[model samples]
Target: MSAKIRLYVDHLLGPGQSVELTREQAHYLFGVMRLAVGGHVALFNGKDGEWLAKVAEAGKKGGKLTCQTQSKPLHMPPDLWFLFAPIKKTRTDFIVEKAAEMGAARIMPVQTQFTNSERIRQDRLQAHAVEAAEQCGGTFVPEVADLQRLDRVLDDWPETRQMMFCDEAEVGSALRLAAQEKGQPWAILIGPEGGFSDRERARLSGLPYAHVVSLGPRILRADTAAVAALTMWQQALGDWL
Candidate 1:
């Protein structure tokens, strides 16, 4: 595997120009990773595309790197989105990481009536998404959306894309639902730990584009629900198919 370093949007990088990485990034690269000057690393700006860079200077407090050439063009991902209720801090981070790893184009934090976490640090979640992309060797990083009310998100939902609601209330085979959702841009909705409110469930079920599906016989946590739903989607209508 090639050496890669995840960077935030604070630094400007281009061919033949030196960009100074932040103090924290400097520590991780030079101090922790023991990467010396002249070592090559890969970088990507969510907008500017992926680039191969060489460490120009290694310093105790900070360091500089120069971008060499573009490794890949800015390619957009599929239209799949993972719309999930935010859980605890660590679990939420795990969900963001897994969503990026699973190739979700967008990770949305939907705030339901039964949702436990009201406050979500979007920057932290975005950072986790970036790290996941770098770790998985993915050129595109999934967008981490801010916390929005479920109703608001649904009200503004695009009519073209289908929403696969992972309903725990359903008890049957998943293939039936999978067959109905084949070959469409989709979003998977996972309820919070306490599950969706009655009104919310009804609203989701009423949507013409929403396809209510079951993960299995057992109940799952919000984080686990996300992974299971995404896995099922990938196997059925996603890229795996």
Candidate 2:
């Protein structure tokens, strides 16, 4: 029978490997979900793809699962990194979830001059990404990084990865990403609700590897901008095509 639950595990998965569940994982699978011995679960470890595992032993606070067979191979997203300024808590959570769902290889909370929040719950946001991957049938989950200064990130930017800067100020400028044939590592940058600072805008615009594009005439919230930018990138240059 097919498993209804997909879980992210840190353990390595293989044809004969047995994965031991932690107390919290056991509680949720055995107590909360009431999964007993012989029950099946889909498991993925980011690097190992997805496997169908059967409960070999069950206890109140722990359990053991043996791998039956591989279900899905590791399907990593494009070499895309999503960098955005953090906003409200719920909205920030929403951005992380959607970024994972939309195939971001990494999610970074950038500290811009106009950014509203000063800190972020990196662990909590990572959990949200895991849940999003589980619920959305994704075998790979993106890493949610801790808050970092945008300037530092840019200063240390690798020349290999191109940056797609979504600037609202460039309203009339048309984005022609689809026609670009060269395949280079890419990243998308979404500014805060207050928008990019003048210095940030000018710096990005002057960057040799940055492509400053518009998201239409209307200004969008930080969260909305993330979704829009991902969609455009996926359709143009990402694996969606």
The estimated TM-scores of all candidates read 0.89, 0.96
Best by TM-score: 2
Give the CA lDDT, 0 to 100, for residue 90 in model 1.
93
Off by over 4 Å in 2: none
lDDT of 2 by residue, 67-88 (tens): 9899999998989999999999
- Lowest-scoring 10 consecutive residues by lDDT in candidate 1? 1-10
| TM-score, structure 1 vs. true | 0.89
Q: For model 1, how does the per-residue alpha-carbon lDDT over 7-43 read when each residue is reduced to its tens digit?
A: 5445555788677888888888888888899997887
**lDDT scores of the candidates, listed in order:** 0.83, 0.92
Clashes of each: 0, 0
Superposition error at 105 for model 2 (Å): 0.4
The reply for model 1, stretches above 4 Å from the true place, is 4-14, 72-75, 173-184
